[model samples]
Target: METLETTKLDLTGKIDVVENISREDFLEFYMKPQKPVIIKHLYGKDAQVYKWTFDYFQKELGELEVGVFDDESETRQDDRSYKKAPMTMKFGEYLQIIQEKPTSKRLFLFNVFKHKKELLNHFKFPNIADNVLSFLPFAFFGGQGAETRIHRDMDNSCVFLTEIAGYKRVVLFDPKYSKLLYQYPYSTHTSIDVNHPDFDKYPGLAHVQGIDCTIGPGDTIFMPSGWWHHIEYNTAGLGFAIRSLSPHYKDRVVGILQVGLKTHIDDLANKILGSKWFDWKKNKTIERANRAIQKLQKK
Candidate 1:
C-alpha cells in the first residue's frame, strides 16, 4: 500500500458491499455469476465477532497447543497449509506474543470449533445456498503485517470468509489470470508479494485486473470458487471461512482431482526428486508466465 502500483492497475474495479440481500438476488447476481461481495454484520446473537478478543481467547483456549507458521519460505509445496506446521506453541502464549508486536508467525486452517463446538451457535449459514459443509469451518489468525500469499483454494470450493476481529486487506483476481499471477505448477500458490508488485520481473501482473478491499470486524466476504486471493492482516486479527461444494458438476470433479489426485502426484514427485522437483516447478511457473506475456504482446 505504501507504493501504490497504480500505473498498470484498473483502480475503478470494486467489490460490492451490501447490508442485506435476498436469496434470489444473491444467487442470480453473485453466486451463479461467481462474483465476490461483502455482507456487513451478517451474524446473529452470540456472534464471536462482538464477544471474542485476544484476551478472551487467551483466557479460554490458552492451554490449547497450536501449529505456528512463519513467512520466510519461498516454495509453497515445501510448506503447505495441509501439512503439519513447522512449529508449535500454547495458544495463550502465541496470543501474548502477537499482541506485543508485529511478527511473521500465523495460525492457518486451525479447527478451533472442533475443541469448542458451542462457538458454532454464534452464526448460521444464510439461505442463499445449500450444502454449507457446516462441520468443517476453519479459522485463520495472523499478526500485524502477516500475509497469506496469492493463491486459490485447491479444492475450488466457494468460501464465506467472516472477519471476527480486527481488519484485513484482501486482493482478488479471477482464475483467468492464473498465468499472469505466476501460479506454480501442481500447486495453488504464487511467490509474488502483491503488496509491492514487481512489474519488471512479473510483467503479466501489469496486464491483470483485480479487486481490492479491506474488511473489518463482523464483515463477511463471499469468495467465489477458484478465485485467487492474497490477504494481509492490518492488525492482529481472526477470521474463519465456511466452504461449500461448487454448484457446477464440472467444478466438483475438478475439486476432487485437485485434492484427491493432483496433490498426490506432487507429493510423489517430491519424494522421488527432492529439491530438483521444487526447482522444476519454479522454472515451469516462470516459463508459463513468459508464454502468457508473449501472448499479450501478440495481441
Candidate 2:
C-alpha cells in the first residue's frame, strides 16, 4: 500500500490453480500441508451451477424473514442484530436493493438447508472433506465492491468456498501472521481492512505474507484452517461455503472456547459497561500490534 516494490512485499499475486485435481493430490499437496489451492473446472453441466442466480434466490427465500447485515446500524446506531437481536427483512425486498446498486448491507443466509431442505436438490456438494459441519452451509450475497472483514472462523474449520455467480477475489494470510493483523484478544476477526489497510498504523502487516485469488463461477478455493481471509465481491457475487474440521479435534475445541465463549463474554461486558468495553479492547489490541511492529523493526 505504501508503493513498495512488489518483490519486497510478502504477498504474491499468484495462487495454486489446478483443474480436476485428483483426490490423492489434494490430500498430499494442499490438505495435509495446510496450504490453500484453487480447483478449476471442478463441476460442469449442473442445473444448480447455472440456475443459482440472483433471480432464483429471490423466489426461494422470498417470504422468509432473512437476517441482513445493517452496516450503519452495526456501528452508528449501536444495534447488534443476530447475536440475539437480529434484523429481519423480506428476502425479495433486500434483493431489490442489491440489484439496483451496491449497498452497505450484506445478505447472509446461514444454514439454508435447515429451513428449506428442498433447496438442496438444486446443487451438489463435492466429496472432499473427511467430515463437514452440518449447520455451516453458508450462502453469502454481497453488493458490488462489498468486502467481508478479515477474520478466522473461531471453530478452526477448514473451508471450501465456491463461486455460484459473479466474481470475487480473496486475500488470505496464514495463521502465523495473526500478531501482525491487529486481532483483538479472544476474537476471531482483525480490525484492519486488508484491501486498504492503514500501513502506518499496522506496520507489522507490511511484512505479512498473503495469497490473492480471483475466482469466478464454479471455481472452489480450499482455505486451510486458521487462515485469515478478506473477501471482496468484484461484482454482485453469490457464493456458498462448506466448512470441515481438521482430523485433529483438540485444538479446534480450544478455539471454540477462545472465540465462542470469549466473544459472548465481550458482548455481555459491552451490554453492562457500554462502549467503554469495546473502546478499551480495541485500544489494547492496537497497542499490542504496534508493539509487535516495533519489535520486528528492531530485529
RMSD of each: 3.3, 3.5
For this target, which candidate reaches the highest lDDT against the unseen true structure? 1
State which candidate has the highest TM-score: 1
Instruction: Give, for candidate 1, the lowest lDDT window spanning 10 residues.
Output: 1-10
- lDDT, candidate 2, equals 0.73
Residue 28, model 1: Cα distance from true site in angstroms: 0.9
- For all predicted structures, in order, the TM-scores are 0.90, 0.85
Residue by residue across 238-269, what tens digits does model 1's lDDT show? 88999987777787787888899888888898
> How do the residues 171-242 of candidate 2 rate in per-residue lDDT, one tens digit apiece?
888887787777776566666766566666667667687887799987889888888888887888788787
